[model samples]
Target: MTNLLLLIPVAIGLGLLGLFAFVWTLRSGQYDDLDGAAERILHEDDEY
Candidate 1:
């Protein structure tokens, strides 16, 4: 029971931290181009 007292706050803090990070990414445009990497690799700028 003693361990639970300390663990609950730690768990809540970690969950909040993760939520903040995800929100930050959303605001920073980190998810703007989900398919860009895969689609970009199929195109080439070099001439054969």
Candidate 2:
């Protein structure tokens, strides 16, 4: 019973941390060029 009291808040805190990280990624444009990234690998570049 005592373990649940401590573990529940810890779990919730971890979940919120994950949600914030995901939201941060969205705000940082991490998903903006999804298709571009997939197609970019197919094209060869002239960089030496």
Q: Candidate 2 regions off by >4 Å?
A: none
RMSD of each: 2.0, 0.7
Q: RMSD (Cα, Å) of candidate 1?
A: 2.0
lDDT of 1 by residue, 1-48 (tens): 999999999999999999999999999999999999999899996866
Local accuracy by lDDT, each model: 0.97, 0.97
**Candidate 1: residue pairs that collide:** none
At residue 28, give the lDDT of candidate 1.
100
Task: Specify the highest-TM-score model's number.
Answer: 2
- Give lDDT for model 2: 0.97
